[model samples]
Target: MNDITPADSAERRRRVARAIQRRMVAHVAAGGTTDFASGPLENDPAAYTDPARAELERREIFLKVPLVAGLSRAVPRPGDSLLFEEFGQSIVIVRGRDGVLRAFLNMCTHRGTKLVRAGADGTCERRGRMTCPFHAWTFELDGSLVGVPGRQGFEGIDMSRRNLIQVPVAEWNGIVFVRAAAGSDELDIPAYLGAFAPELAQLELADAAPIRSSSLAADCNWKCALDTYGEGYHFATLHASTIGVSHYGNVAVFDDFGPHWRINFPDRRVKALVGLPESEWPEADYGGVHFLFPNTVVVVGSGGPGGAFVRMFRIFPGQTPGTMSCRIEVYALRGVRADGDRAGEFAQDDAESDVTREDYRVAVDGYANLVSAPAGFTVVYGRNELALQSLHRHIARAIGVPL
Candidate 1:
């Protein structure tokens, strides 16, 4: 395979540079709400690289935020339930018989054992109770410890008064959220979602069930993994072999919403977006990318609504100073009408998923090299780095660390 010459890179890089300049200038000229010059957490270096500092954040910031422990997706039916771990706490998300979404700590009150193991499907034996396998401790779907294996073991044990710990949880825009600490106050999920709420509310994501799910552990910083996504700046070179012609938009249009951020761009291959002049670019059919506070990133469009043809979610973690685990969720719009009949939704979804996996492989390799350096320094983030900066600042503010 022929490598891209310096001249080819220069030409494409120049185009991307000019696009970013224009977008930034226009955003400021229009009096956009974000202040990119100096954000609240712009200079906090400890939050990103310090393990001890990150631990404090893991306790107060991540646990109480309501963003980390929420229900990401759910089915409205009563039997539907989901489980995930967040901020070192195991969370159980279930829909009660009244079809209310409830979240509880997945722990058995006896011996302080974790009731459910990881990767197990959700189940509730009673209308509101889930059974513990270790000691056969049965808990209500709502977390009430209604049954114990032996009544004779404890003469005065009050099962009625001994219920499984319930955590504060709220579901909004089809995603469920939880607060791990006991006696923690409820969070306004809608407000916490900030600007992304409008678009999310329109998605109706709960109507869709996860058809397939996969996770991968990588030896790289969580932010490093997430930063590799969003911008198309590296596409032409990094993905030259497989995805050279499918999409376009090497430019990134970054918009900040307090701690949340959104990045939008037009795929050059999409005739709906590419045919128009750069200034008149259609925002309606163009692709959109959104980051939910800290760890969730979704790419939509180039396919249709919910990107009927495309949808990908990235869940990454700060496993260590330099290692991260990322889980990618890919879903294709099933039984949805498309504006165009050019490609099948499932085929397009699979193709997009492949591209993402390829990107992950390359990024992890790059991260390994960076962390191995003897004298570590800051990595330079150019105009394409706005989304990352936005995320970093948000994390700093949330942690109450100086930015």
Candidate 2:
């Protein structure tokens, strides 16, 4: 983990502010518009409808790649724990009493019963000691099987050899990452982030706590739901009644950070920073949307009159190719108390859900149409949707398939 001091945090914010100012200036100089890609990109329709390819992705990408299991705040205390089911694998992320975080299969070492079960929305509270409900088997937070009922029946059984299976886990910039498959190499979060590390570190996510989380089932592929967020092209037409009123249409700054990408969409408020000095410009005047490689999208914006907030979207493949699950987590700066904070948080949550529902509605319709589309059908991603193009390319490369 990188030790980021106050000076480092301030410097990162200043750097981002300067970069945005430069882009704004260049946009004005070039006739008040953002740049565009050379041409549109095309993707095969089967990439979203193929069951065989989805299974391969489940093994190669979902299992092998480091996925954002949850935020650091999900297990803030030493005894805090949570269960995550991704790609059909049950994972338990826990913070041990030694102040270390670890991941393991959420199963009893004796007889393989699930150690814990998530609530309706796939979330649960911390458990100091995990006990399998099926049998009287108990285990510690660090996946050490300490007690087993009916031990006399299993004579000469080595307890040390029967510890719960451990999965590779790491925390970076307040995000928890896990690799579910056994014997997989440790996921180096920093190395994987590459040049984006410094920028992501600037978000100061560790200084925030998750305020609310909710999930919705979508009648579309996981990628289809994710594609809705990779571009702002639909804001004017699809979101005209909601976000489109406050945000500009089809105007954004795009940049690549390794396999990840970021799209900065300036709201009507961004015009206020046009002539201001770089030092005086607000750090988060624009909506900063970051697409973490593979599955997560982090959207950062101002929290009303004070503080800041972030909304993270994690999309996972469902039981079939035509279904997907989307989880949204909203977080705010820790220790920042103000009047009507709860009201403000609830308002934000409602507003986000309203806009997200619109996106999903369109995506679901698109998916249904694609399933019945004629042969040789292909989806075209306009130049304005470069992020989608890049994301599809990475997915194809990971699954060894052609887009």
- Tell me model 2's lDDT, rounded to 2 decimals: 0.81
Each prediction's Cα lDDT score? 0.59, 0.81
**Model 1 ranges with Cα > 4 A deviation:** 1-49, 68-73, 117-128, 242-244, 270-283, 302-314, 332-343, 370-376, 400-403
- Candidate 2, 295: how far from true, in Å? 0.4
The prediction achieving the highest TM-score against the true structure is: 2
lDDT by residue (113-164, candidate 1, tens digit) is 7776544333323334577778888876667777888878977877676787
Query: Taking the tens digit of each residue's C-alpha lDDT, what string does model 2 give over 219-317?
Result: 898889999887777888998987888876677788898679888765666677667776786565434888888899998876776667888998899
Choose the strongest candidate by lDDT.
2
User: Residue 135: error of model 2 in Å?
Assistant: 1.3
Runs of candidate 2 exceeding 4 Å displacement: 25-32, 119-123, 272-287, 334-336
